[model samples]
Target: MQIRPFELERYFARHEFSAKYLLGSSDPEAMSIADLLAFEPGSEEELKRVWLGYTESLGDPALRRDIAGLYESVAPEEILVFTGAEEPIFAFMHAVLEPGDHLVVHFPGYQSHYSVAQSRGIEVSHWHGNPNRNWAPDLVELPELIRSKTRAILICTPHNPTGYLFDRSSWQQVIEIARERDLYLFCDEVYRGTEHDPADQLPHLADHYEKGISLNCLSKNCGLAGLRTGWIATKDRDIYNRLATFKDYLTICNCAPGEYLAGIAVRNMPQIFEQQRVRLVSNLNLLAEFFARHTDLFSWQRPRAGTVTFPRYLGGSALEFCDWLVAETGIMLIPGTFFDMPGEYLRFGYGRASFADALARLDAYLAG
Candidate 1:
């Protein structure tokens, strides 16, 4: 099945490697394997001995258990590993949705959340987020958008770009909507551990909703994108079995080495989250000051979680401003149009080591 180009990934491909300041990256600062295993004894030896062969199709048992520990209700048996978060999205949309099925997805958000379903000729509706309310979607509008063909609701909390998260009440309302309608829930929770406050961390969708599917990976929160490992957690036996069957045609098993590293990383999640939390809180403060200084040039609602902030570019079109900024300062930022957003907004990611330097450069570039 053919699909529209993933604009966000495409833009990153062109600039991610060469940009001097990676101010557009959403993943947090990554650590060396040595750094990751510094506190865990004997991890290095086990990694060296991790057999270089196809791993269990269902995922390595040890790794699955660590992943299951991330949730309150999910078990090791309910988790299925894949190449990355992207893979489960493709697999789930294909296995569970049909050509005429209707899907309601978060808007001004990630492309993959809707594109895969759209490619299948499904009727997809945008559940628009309110900039007026820190990009929160109005629960009142969800039912109006639903049709008899509606089959699934796709949600991203601590959402991409805007970093909008559903509070306890808001989250429960969403679950109630799905339950009332019998619609499957697909929650892309790759940024689960990136909450600005540890207290704000929500319950895992898979653990709370019987049919909810939680897609997570080592990319964003764990800062282990190189691992190329992601998994799906759900209590639905039928979907679990169907996704397993579908994987035979795609990647039947994960890379053995990546699995070992992912296992080690998940096992030490508390440290990773704390490390990332300090960085994000610091960066968010810097961004707030930057925006305040240039009040006329930008307007933004500070995000509640996640690394990126979609700020409206008041000086010019986001694409043009980003292009000029990169050419003039070697700092990279993303245009909101990439996410089908109809505003002059830039998706600035402030979750890296060099983010302060990038902001300083942007300040100089704007002044000149």
Candidate 2:
């Protein structure tokens, strides 16, 4: 199947490694292997004994059990593991959608949400978020976007870039709309555990809706991007089977060592999430102060969750500003154009240990 080049990944390929400070990364600060293994006693010894062989295609049983623990109603048998969140997304596009199918997706989101479907000749309608409302999409507009051929509604809560999480009422409204239309509800919950306020955390969609598919991974909230382990949890047996079958054409099984390590991370997620939450909250505070001081150069809205935030750049085109900023300062900020959003907006990530230093450098550059 022919597909357009992934704009965000392509941009990252050009600069992610070379940039001195990554101020546009979406994942939190990652821990070393030693730091992660330290969470479980004797895990270091267990890692040494992991067999270097093909693993269970559905996923390691123990790891699936640990992942199932994240949801209230989903079972290990219902979860399908993949190399990363990307695989399941690709699989769903090929396995469930057809050339004439229609999909409604949350706008200004990860490219794969729509790009893969588009490649297969599917129609995609964007459900956009409002900047004035802290990026929350209006529920009333949802039903209007659905067509007779619509098959599913895809969303990213505790969203990427904007960090706009849905409140319980709004989330329920989305579920209701999908249910009324008998449509599949696909939620990209990669940033599920990063709510700044624990009280604002929403339940896993699979647990609450029979047709809901919750796509998650170790990359964002768990700060274990190196593990490259992710999964889809769904109570719909048919959907689970379809995704599992399509995965065989991709990476049939996960990295055995990555699965074992993921099991460790999942088992001790409370502590791991706490570590990331603490760092994220600290960086967010600094960002608040930085944006407040530079209101003349940008417009800001504090995000409800996730590692990144979209701010409007008052200084000319955001693309040009990002290009100039990275070239002149070696600190990288992603332009909104990569997310299919162009003009004045740019994405700033505050999930790294170097956020303070990077912000300071930008501040100094502005002052000069």
- Per-candidate Cα lDDT values, in order, are 0.89, 0.93
Worst 10 residues of 1 by lDDT: 10-19
What is the per-residue lDDT of model 1 for residues 239-276, given as tens digits with 9 covering 90 to 100? 99989888887899999988988888898899898999
Worst 10 residues of 2 by lDDT: 12-21
| Residue pairs clashing, model 1 | none
RMSD of 1: 1.1
lDDT of 2 by residue, 201-283 (tens): 99999999999999999999988899999999999989998898888899999999999999999999888888889999999
Which residue segments of model 1 deviate by more than 4 Å?
A: 16-18
Model 2 Cα shift for residue 35 (angstroms): 0.7
User: What are the per-model C-alpha RMSD values against the true structure?
Assistant: 1.1, 0.8
User: What lDDT is reached at residue 240 by model 1?
Assistant: 96
